[model samples]
Target: MSAVHEVAPVVDAAHAEPYATRDEYAGAIGRIRSAAEAYYAGADLVMDDAAYDALLARVAATESAQPGWAASDSPTTTVAAGIAGGDVEHSTPMLSLDNVFDGDELASWAARLERVLGRPANGYTVEPKIDGMAVAARYVDGRLSQVATRGDGRAGEDVTVNARLVAGLPAELARPVTVEVRGEVFMTDADFERANELRTGHGGTAFANPRSAAAGTLRAQDRAYDAPLSFFAYAVHDLPGGEGLFHSAAMAAIADLGVATTAGPMAAITEPGVTATTTPTAATTDPEATTTSSPPAGMPLCATIDDVLAAIESLGAARGSLGFDIDGAVVKADDPADRDRAGFSSRAPRWAVAYKFPADTRTSRLVGIEVQVGRTGVITPVAVLEPVQVGGVVVTSATLHNFDDLVRRDVRVGDAVFVRRAGDVIPEITGALLDARPDGATAFMPPQVCPRCGGEIDRSQKRWRCVRGRACGAEESLAYFAARDSMDIEGLGDKVIAGLVRAGLVTDPADLYDLDAESLAQLERLGRTSAAKLVATIQGSKTQPLSRVLTGLGVRMTGRSMSRRLARHFGTMPALQAATVDDLQRVDGVGPERAATIAAELAELAPVIAKLTARGLTMSEPELPTRPAAPGSAEALEAPRLPLQREDGSPMTVVVTGSVPGLSRTEGNEAVERLGGKSSGSVSKRTDLVVVGDGAGSKATKAEELGIPCMPAEEFATLLAQLTAVRLG
Candidate 1:
């Protein structure tokens, strides 16, 4: 047996806190256990991966420093924090891996392994530590029988039904031999997109990340639709007539038997002629690649620990383009003999270690806490942070989600906090860096009344709301309505709107139409001439398109594109108001929740709509270009090709960035829709085109990076004119 040795107490830079007291240690342990439970149960995580890891490290350091202070039920002593439960017994313990954050820690781990073996290790194999759920699939006589999660190592929950549907995990193997395949179930980038589409289509909230999506989908028995899942085998066990085979050979053998392995095929090198190559060819072993009839490829076989480190570094460099998420690289002793000699720890195998990449997270100081009221009157606390770069973006502020979340996290002003871009996109403060907090830092108090109107608070839900609802934020609503992108009402700014609201002349958007030049002239700074011009602008706004009217109304879920869609689909305001939840769902991206929210908001604003209608506003959207006749029909052959549409007649998704000549951002987007293309707000891989203009920033950069076709604003303007002429003709 390998001698039991304590890991050296080396704190990662991210985990500098030593948990100086028992209370501190216990507090950390409690948080870690809670996070582990939420993670394994496929629920929304209260803490991010980085924060949890930091806390775990802090707990371990404290336990090491004060030996007898460790509790029996501490997360340090448990596999998966002892939260994940199951009834199915694994053939062998499904062990977790100890983590090493940097090359020094990794090298130290390697040295320990060498000491246990009483020699330099034979070789190492590095594979992506896919950020996914771990499972073991038992194949009886070459046919897949059952699958179970890696719950608490020794036993796991059976999920046979869901496992059968996963890609890369074939129901029947090429050879009908009894063996257990251990692998990860995860969602690829495409799979994640498809999953979100399906989920949102069915009225469910979209998942935050692919790992969580895979986990939830894998364990769910009552889902109305299946989200896609993928599997990659990392180890095989209990194969007939295959004892003492090198770990590399076993992996290749499994691949030959039609199981997917991320490390690809690794040729067993019994001789000294094998050399490692730096370039990545291991991606050819991806299960998606197998569909193109590519031959099975091999991953690098590292002859030494140095080579293993190089392979890990190469993998890290290639991470962003992999089309999948990997939190780290798993490096293992390649020889079965070496693994046998190293044996097992109570919670993990000594043969392997996970080299964790630093999380895309950073630390920033919380300068202040402020609350903002949304259109729905929900009061959310936002953190004003000292500018920090996280995931390639400078974040100055982050939403605390709600007051309850703020209290739960216990973050305070003057505290150095852990900041990460949640989903690699949104800036979020997970928790405070207590070790860096100032002596006088204190908890922030939630506003008992609405910050905007000083109205009574509705504290029934975690997200507190104001009793006055939309009326509480009337000035904000009016400002948006008169903004250049919406109604285009000139001379009406925030100060004017606030003065009008204070004078009780405007309580909702509908009240704005009731003001004449005489009433408007009574406001604080307005003169007769200015009020007359403002009134003329407000009256002229009545002639704006129905899409603009929808934008000005500030519907909960309807943005520019959505408003256009609703206006086009329903044609008139009356039709939209008459739409049922099911009818509203017919609009693109309008799922059940969004549809319900839209319907309820409309119903609440029925009086406002009546007032606007009485004021003779334009209520009907213009018709779209007439669709050509059915394909292969007589009219179809004679049909003129629609401008801005693909040959297949589908509308192109176009994004407009920066300023276009003589056009506001909203007008530019509207022009795209009017020209037979759909306008998107952001640039993504799927974006077909981008209209670039002066001062275009990240969106323009992203379009160029993605290789999406781009047109200059001048060219776009010319094209828009031509399209408009064609449509008119």
Candidate 2:
């Protein structure tokens, strides 16, 4: 129940302005609006939630100082800062709850409620505040009719079509009575992983967090496949059969009608003598939906403020194991009479207050700033921080994303800076705690030349990249070239590649083929025997198909699958290099931007490609029956379909997980493609088959859960061999 200590304001922070001037105030307003819109739209958020709250607090303080200066459209006067707009009006305004950061604040809110009620509240209900998008589901005769988002608390966009796919939100309630259920729509951890897998498999970027995934999935229509979503009702807005019920009682009723409430698994902690009541729910047949069979730990019924705080603290402690994100705890007057007495404010209800936990962020000293060159030559500034625990991980370094973000945050070496584990995964420097800055702390200077190759910097994009691209990151490119999924060169690990780069023995991947055992043995640590093996492995890669070479090349905007696609489409390196952007786009999943980037990358790597060709390396893909004659050329007739083709000639989406007997993961994927199947890394509803191997882990379990067909690795290997033998004949 202890309150997190307050942080002193930073003097040099980007949002440090006091907003005393009109221009400064206006700037803050604009920034808040932009951030809110991006957040609601499930786009990349400009600032973390903690930073946004701080900025909003500053604006609030300023507005309170000069009440006359506040405008009608001021963000303080609107829900979500007035960013959301929609056509569907809510039956009642879905007001947001005011936040309480500490026990003292919580006490003050309770006191205010007591004053309004003219007596102490009979009871309080505390529930975990699910971190998700808010939506209102309208039911007619106990059947789900429409679902809308909580846009501006007044109206929202209709999302009934997508909502029908969500789990926990039953299509029909137990009783055939009308009601408007207000709840948070969210993705569970498993759902997020599955969703990301599905998105990336389709050549789309993964969502940053579960909240973003839930928001995007809930709003998306016409998706090729449904991403799993879960719902938990917090309020029943219009209950036809139930009126003036206590808040806790209403939640219990909602649960009985086959809806999951925030009570979740922990089931509510009851007062000393009261036994928790079990809520009834109908069994669900929907595979994509979440089902709750246990009685919701009823919103712990709290008779006192201390009891409420205890319930909140208990929920916070169990946060990590909840299997979903809960940003805070919501405390509300349980008695309907008390809520009526307290009434509502313009923006939020007075009967409820949210006690937000300190965000998964901490302050640590920025010991140093190091520039790391990415595989694609993007220069990223990494903050070397004094080890600090964030989101349960000891974070020693955090990404600054780019120079612009580094500058915007104004983080300097030797300063105590704010580090947040973005999405509970990647540690990122959100901003600097400038008030704690040490004397003589200096700002970081962005590199004018590429850190690795000293090449010219391309400042055209926000992410600073080297003009030489992959060539500037020769060490990375060479390692990638020798990777298991690419050239399958066993002896050329990162250390060996680094030695080659450092000794000036290799400037590009092609140079690896030129190293003799005698020349390689001269490096600091390499023995003659090891060098010979390395040389032999390098030479062996020359026999690999053009698809492997293309994969090794690290072409921009392309991956192993895209390389395979390009190799299968063009067959020869010369044909691919000569293809225009339009020709590249003709391949599945490639758009104009990606095609143009690939075209440019191929052009830049022409000299290296020629070197590989001169070395007698394979420059052509395996001869397939369906290779295109030319871009946009009509096929004389449909070429014979391979064994793995579906009835309509489309390739089956096959996922190969774990280790296949006698075949590497790369080989397994290649075999799938050769047999006329599209190999996918993730298992989803759309996946036609899963080839399970030893220790297949989660993907195997996921396949079983989804009722997808699975074949043993040995069976798949035998089938692939038969297909390959038939193709060769």
Candidate 3:
């Protein structure tokens, strides 16, 4: 809602015509209902507001023309069907509001309400339409009793714990009263920035928008993370008596009870038969309707549509400065009795309507389409656009998401397109303006090779990845390969890895083995002495255990623990490479799907493994404890026997707990691996032995419970010494 200025209606050509058949109306209603359900569930909207409004308008017009033909559960007649998973039933249904986009639609809605009331409807209150999750908090006596989300409008999940964590939400009321207060849970801009920062710091995916962030945070079962959320009570219902208070009075009472309400006072729209052309200056408008820099102390009264329009314009102009995001302005009947008399539709109140602002969009020319390779080797197309300002941000490029999205939008290199930012970090092209398409524009074809590495592309999946694997994601892969848990190559930090990739000195992990002091010194900031040390570090990493090497490979579904299990099970790179899908599935953590993926990946790494081995890297497990030969047996002459083996002469599954006298947990695990035994972090029935060290905890107790043999730290040390003696004998 803005100043009452006469402007032509911006009609959508596609939906300008009225529905011609009952089937068309039915189809439109069904689509709208599905979209509303998804939107309420915090999922991506199936259709944008504009398109949805057009369809809704069509359905409404159809219903008006032929009331008998309207479906019983049509979107126009019913609230969104609540999503599943709610555990708490609501006392009453939470309804949706009808939306009007411009002055013409607003006038039409106002005129309809007047006809229903049999008089010029007066006393309207306007407030910001917060874009957030709707919630209801029930207070018994003075203490907060329960909180629930607006699930399907009828019921919602109990979120009392999470709700109490939200800032500005009061746990107790000022006076003892039993009531249910409805409000919005939202994240401010600063809150969104900090939340995303924390998420990215912990390597979690960042939320796309504030509304989504609020919804996810509110619905989380664990209230551990310091998630920032704020709430504003909009409406309150007193239980038992069930009497509704006036809109302005209810908001005031909620605020008095220590709950924050929407910013700005309720501006009354009381003009009778006011058309879009009606205009009034400050002199002609009510003195009470004069605007203020900040929200007034209480609700302001507007005597004419001109005053209402001015107030809306003022709010719209101040939107960017507001702490929370508002999608539109809401107009409600000021008098509670008037609202009740107007009655309710199945889904919405007939006495109120929301006037949505136009979407923040800008038309810009698509200069070109550039495909960028992600760390996972997914090739995403970016639209290079002529610089355009959208939502106060200068957007030069927009994401196409993927090739499929690119084709679905049918955006072309030389076509004019509309860009929208919304809450996404990156702007996106809403759609191509086909009317402004330049001649000779053609559909974009995905590249046959990776744009960065010129490697073969795998198009079998929804997102195309490089057949060269991590080699195509060079720098990131190199960093992971050199990480402490992997190759443990000291001094190979992000800056060093970035310089190496940029200088084209490295492409694959094997290239690290080829670097000498002279080659390393050529990198900026690496002195001769530093280069020598780096070279030595790279040389030393070649002998890091097989598990470390596997972890460095960056295989999908394989991490430190899984890598260790695989190395222990296979015993050698050649053995693991030769593993069939069925063979891989036998390993502890590998499922059928994961087994197939590992098998296929290992096949691809065959050549890379051969190269690393050729470069002097370790390719097989070290010798394990050999079985003692019976009197004068050939095995006794072949190899020295060690004492760490089980009675059956198989390697023991040893669980080491607490502090060893001189060895760290990692060192102890490494020693076990070196002795041809599997080191486990937990004790189980499968464990052959448990090594108990000082301050031994639950693992030691569990070992005793399971009747697994226990060895003290001194005994384990003596056993290692005996193994060493046999190896040297």
Candidate 4:
């Protein structure tokens, strides 16, 4: 394990001094807790689990050591409350079930239940424990009333607005009686898969697990349960007197009322440790009302819990075949009368506990990282980690995600990154112990050139990508050339591109025009039949339509939709190439800046087209996309060039070098855009200005070499303020 390796401390706050005052200690606890709650809601975990535990321990020790320093928020006196942002006022407090790790622990817990209730449980209703948020939903009369989370034990977030969006929480109850049903708010296996897929599609990070997935979704501001988050009722609370319903019967009632639930209490009969009461205080009030007179003499058989647990275990064994996810089995006492007798604790009822199954864990080393450019032009850096055993399976490399992550984590070339797997899935990084850093470790730097095209790289408000965009002469060109909106070259995929590239027969798009049968025969996998077929395919690219040719050129911001609009706007390649930005803006859908980009692109590619013509490449200029004639004007005139302007209408191209306190390298570009200026990715003689922050080495020196005006980030900000004032005045 990487944990065993010894090295320097990573973010080591371990030896740091403790809080000097009690109030500070208490305040720290609240601060840490708030951070944890917000972070768990949507963002990444800021502090590791162990770090949090250590903080909690520190708070407890401080509160005990100095009684005068004790405050209301002290960890010693108060528990970390559940998230309070939810508006859900549950029908009853959503209580937490006791947790047990092993079989022996489960049995020992069951034994304790028997002692408290004075008899064996009659039967148990075993169901697959849903790995999700616990929720309690209430229906007043015939309609949905309130829904809340299992917040710190007593209070939870009021997520009624969001809860009402969930599929299982019906607006109108089937039975028409006042009912409060409890269930797990979860994302289904399919739903979890789809959500992650959508996240991947949107160039966002994938969620870790279904439980976290469900929780994160609900915690988002301005989002509702209208998404496909699923729910299944497991327990219920109903009754004016709060004394009549049995544990099994209430669950059965929940099922009958249109809430999907497990078949509870198939066989069972120990009296339970608690009962349902609809009153606000019934949850806390009734539990402490009953008490045992004396300790049990022998191994007391459960009266309510025994049967309930037995049934629960049987259901657990059948969970996998039934098609769902489960982490453990729940065992609660059945006898309503005995449950009231055993009373309550601060967090959970005395009768119930979850018996969990063991998960496997193993460790591996990280060896290397590889960069992958996604479909949306976002470049993600994936680690080619050292192969290792985890969760009883062999695991190799995991993801480092992106360049920003690479810089933030400070993961180096040779450091050992911990990989962990669970539930038979690919391994992922759980920890990076810098103490385990190896000698000669080098920081990973993102490539300034495109890994695929060897073209200049640039960053935008969204992500970093090849500056060449679709114009980059690379494998992406092959894909674009073969796509439906382009040349419609069928059967040319990545494998075909690979075969051609490796054969030393295809580098530029023009190389495809020079392929021969003799060169094809030398390929490892290619036969004479296939060779001729590929050669024939290359020759047919000449007959492609004008729209296809335009899209196939891989123009930036010109996808199928944009291509169609541009095709209709100019109607011909010559017209498009000659049309100025002003003429472009005159077209229906093309904005002024978009027209400028199009004009610039046309001018840029004119040489490329000339080269193809000189080489005798087919030039099938079609009458398609012909522009409409304007009175006393020429439609084919060249567009004039103008300087790019910032958001505040100032002409500027600010180049940022090094790191800024208020912005990331990427965010600085946005800041420039917000100030009404353009952000140039590179520094050259023509560059208007450069913002140099800390670590200004290569780019700053380059700016000096180019004789471009430069300013520190602070100075740049001051300059921007001056510019803003000038514009405003």
Candidate 5:
């Protein structure tokens, strides 16, 4: 166990002064160490990396100011401590890299190193800081011996069996030399998706992100059932070393031993206003250097700070194209001797620092809290924030998710809060800075009554809802009903819906048919011309197919595709209204729970359906050619054949994926349906065929795995033509 204590002071203020006492500094150091241990253990983080770095900097500054008061085993002087999972001790400490947020900080670090050396340093090496789980692998006599995770800097969990199963990690080295190699294990975005699909298929919870997926897979006891993971060597240590090689040379040596590194040769960083000298390092001076296998190609060398910045920029630009995730880039001193002279800090090497890219999180003041009623009548709280930029977008509002989250985060009006763009969209308040909170800022309580309709609130469930049902969420429902994929009602938007709801002119979708130019023209912003156009559009919507009408109804768990399937299965609104739960469940993708929900929603909306039907809306499917019975045929006597039925006299289950030439994905699914086949969004064992199109990804792979027949777009089109001809004939 590491002697460094793991606890840290919580600095809740954004601009609070540094620690004034040794106790305060010690607390901050302990907190940082604890957070790092949790992070390495794949547990929930108490604070984000930005906050962790701030506290770490404070501890470092405090130690520098009063060295006599500093503990001998302080976190600042030790590598990250290990957790209890792994029993294997590392030959050398796996130090965590210190981080700098921007170019200025990076330059300052570089300048500090040069100043310590009393002259300009030789150069620097830059590489990506892959966001993944770190592990050290030991090779004995060119054979795979053992692998351990970075449990704490000194010891890690032994995971040799699991490590051997990773796709890209080499099981054995080419040469018979005892060595230890350190690298990261990660999962690509594509692998993460596949892993989630497999997990959900087997009734398991899906992982939240790629890094978590990789970590969980590496640590799982059942290695055979774990998801696929990849590895990349970043550093190497020879057991019987003669001399230390340059960082780049060490990476090349690992690559030569049949292990894959993150990328080829590191980018070289030259000092400003100086020309880079092409001096060969010790590893390159070996007699067998020309004969030794070269590293995998395409790692570019950068000269000067501008060049390094450019390299970072280029990497950022190409981030989306990479198969794996990287949170930052590492800048390391190129000269091995210079690194030795700079020496090691307790937790990190002094010669290197990771330049972390700007995070998606930003601080903003909470101006107010607003309640919004969702289409399902659930009341959600939203934070109105003073406009702030996060993840390159200006965000004005963030979601509090629910009343529980609102209170849990303790976010209040006038409080400074940390806002982050979740998944690069959907701004959310991660936490509030209590130290910077205003004196008058008070806790916000969710309204007992619906904010929009003054309806009674039901707090019996985790998410509170309005007892008035659709009446409380009428505007939201109206907007969804008018959406392009739903009813496709033109000239009707949020503003129009709000106006109609405020004027009491529209209470439900059925009320849209009752609207007229005179009534609409009376609303704010709607003039004579606009009102006439809107009325005309509403009138035209009466001719829309049953699928659109079902989507417009806003049934829970029923979207465009499901609506279309339900419409096709029932043929008409009357048939659907009369369907039992079992009958509804017979449709593809409609399970028992969904069937129950659909049945209950339909039962509740019967009156609305009748009103819409009475108002002249189309409630039945369009007529299609019915197959004629063959003379004296026993099959003909049983039932009429649907237009979508296959020649074998059964409904074909087809999965349509990606974009098809000459037809949208929607059109492709509709084409399958028109021929009496069931169209599904996902490929499964039940699927009879998969219609693959351009950009077809995981679905195609799954179909191949299941041995389901796949057809190209042209073949599908040809099949559709044949089916149409046979149906018509």
Candidate 6:
């Protein structure tokens, strides 16, 4: 056995308190067991570490008060399993691979393996360990009969019901065969978003990543609710009654059975071979040069330690085209018979090892937190960090996740944080090193103002948002309205919007319908043509369909998703506006919170719509974003709308005044351009819109002073919707 882990107590609260008895000690032990289960199972922690320690201390006092009751299994007697734990299960026992940090350690392990087998080894298999949920599925007579999650090596939860739901799992076999398979259940990029959208709307918490979501879902008592999640099988134990079902054969069988098992690993393999020499080669003759030779072909490929590194490099270039995520390559032995000669240690197999490339890391200082109000009013708290170079890109900000995380990690302004841009280039703060902490750091408390609207904020489920939703938050509300499914205002540029706000003209979505060139000409960058194009686009949006109008409202708890459901259900703007909480509750996916939010938002906007309608804004169901044309109907499948704007490719057309989010003036402009748009420095009929991130000085009141639409940071999405449809042609 290895040396016992050292334990050092940090704090002592219970030591100064009362109650030194055996019964109290038992109760404390029970609490730790329960808390440990939740933490390891990937569930929320019910108690903090301090509280857990206190309990242990209390138990210790009890044991001291009455030593006879301190049994071997007593809480005070066992080691405290530090926080960090669980996954479902492997088809077969997924034993942990032994790790060796250095070449010498690896060499030691190999030496031990050879001793057990009494000879040299020839072949082995090495694969990158996927960081995800693991499960084992058993097929009986070519039909899936049982599925279980990895619990502890020996036993696991029976998740057969949920496993069967994943589309990849075949209900019946293609050939008459019984198979046991192992794989990961994951949510794709789209499913992850859809699930989180619904979760936010329903007042439920979201999982951290696909792995966490899949793991928790497998353990769910109510498997039917989240059946939409996806799964992909990788390992299989189906051969000549388990004879042909080794590593390579298992993958092929999984593919034949219709499960998209992991592809590419089995191909171009070069397991290492080890043979002891009778004597060392004479150094005087340069023996190293005698044994080494050039690679076989286009790229270098080697099988022995003599040529293994070259083979890995060639295979890495091919991974991108292989359709899987590979962090490194594993090298085992090619001959199974020879592998027996290598044997194994109590921890690791002697024949295989992993060689990984260097990971990308960057240093950044946590500057501040920026609260952004989205269309659904679920405010996302983004972290504003000092610009730092990571993977050759300058990242100025990262996600702090949510309120709970901020408190848990104790991340504060001025602290140095490590940032990582994952596979999709999404910037996130993974962890921090407290040893590197400097002085004068303080915790951040979310602002009470609507950062853009100067409105009071409301907090729910640990998220804070402006009560007015889009009504107060301009840029966000505007972009939401201008979204493809919303107003489809094509030509409005974000620069034009900022120009209007800075020059004092465009205010509210209503103001877009009232622009003229004479006033726009006065704005900083506007001349004759830009003003005319802006006015023309504004006039054109008057004929947008009713579904688009409904979406343009920037309703709380509503986005492209809720809007579609509402539009399809009501079929018209007036009907949807008239929907009550009781009415919206009947929709397939609308929960109570969503229904209430929708009803409240529509009720508040009744007057605004009445004005637009009276002015002859064309309001009818546009067939652009329809679900599928059912048996007797002709509709598009969740019809894809040419989004008035996208956050990724172009920037939102907007002007800013009074406090905006922390985005600097130039950066704010860049943010708009990347989303497929530009920014306007002033507010005018010819100008598109205005955005206010933070500290919006006199410019904000002036836009209001000019009766122009002034948007706060969050409403950028709504404004972009209208601008996307606002075009010169």
Model number with the top lDDT: 2
In candidate 1, which residue pairs clash? none
The residue ranges of model 6 lying beyond 4 angstroms of the native Cα positions read: 1-129, 132-241, 246-380, 386-394, 402-404, 414-426, 448-454, 479-507, 514-534, 547-552, 555-570, 578-604, 623-729
Tens digits of per-residue lDDT, candidate 5, 541-656, equal 99888988988888876777778778877889999999999999877657666788789889988999999999999998664334322423567445565544655456678888
Query: Candidate order by TM-score, highest to lowest?
Result: 1, 2, 5, 3, 6, 4
TM-score (all chains, Cα) for each model: 0.59, 0.54, 0.46, 0.42, 0.49, 0.43
lDDT by residue (tens digit), candidate 2, 171-219: 8888898998998888765676578768766666556556767888888
Residue runs of model 3 more than 4 Å from their true location after superposition: 1-16, 19-30, 62-69, 81-87, 239-245, 263-299, 361-729
Candidate 5 wrong stretches, greater than 4 Å: 1-17, 81-92, 115-123, 140-143, 151-155, 172-179, 186-230, 238-260, 264-300, 313-327, 334-347, 357-493, 497-729
Q: Against the correct fold, how does model 5 do in TM-score? A: 0.49
Candidate 1 per-residue lDDT, tens place, 639-709, comes to 55555666655668898998899888878988887776878765655579999999999888767755789
Clashes of each: 0, 4, 1, 58, 18, 113
In Å, residue 402's CA in model 1 sits off its true spot by: 3.0
Name the better of 1 and 5 by lDDT. Answer: 1
Q: Candidate 6, 198: how far from true, in Å?
A: 22
Clashes of 6: 113
Ranking by lDDT: 2, 1, 5, 3, 4, 6
lDDT of 6 by residue, 1-729 (tens): 000001123235324243466666566677766655553364433443334545555666666777777756554333223222234444445432343323454456556655666754443344443334556778788777887765544356787776665645566656667777676655543444455555544555554343444556666775335524554554556454445334445555556665544342222211111111111111111100111111111212233442444344433433322222233455555454544455554323456654432222345678787876664445666889888654336788887656655655566777666565433344666444454456877777766677766777776655566687554556555665665556766656576666665555655677667678777767767788877876787778888656557667766555443455566567777877777889998764565666786787678777777778876786665442323334223332233323323323222345655443545454455345423343444443233456665677655654554455656676654544454455322
Stretches of candidate 2 above 4 Å error? 1-367, 385-396, 413-442, 453-456, 466-472, 494-503, 524-532, 623-640
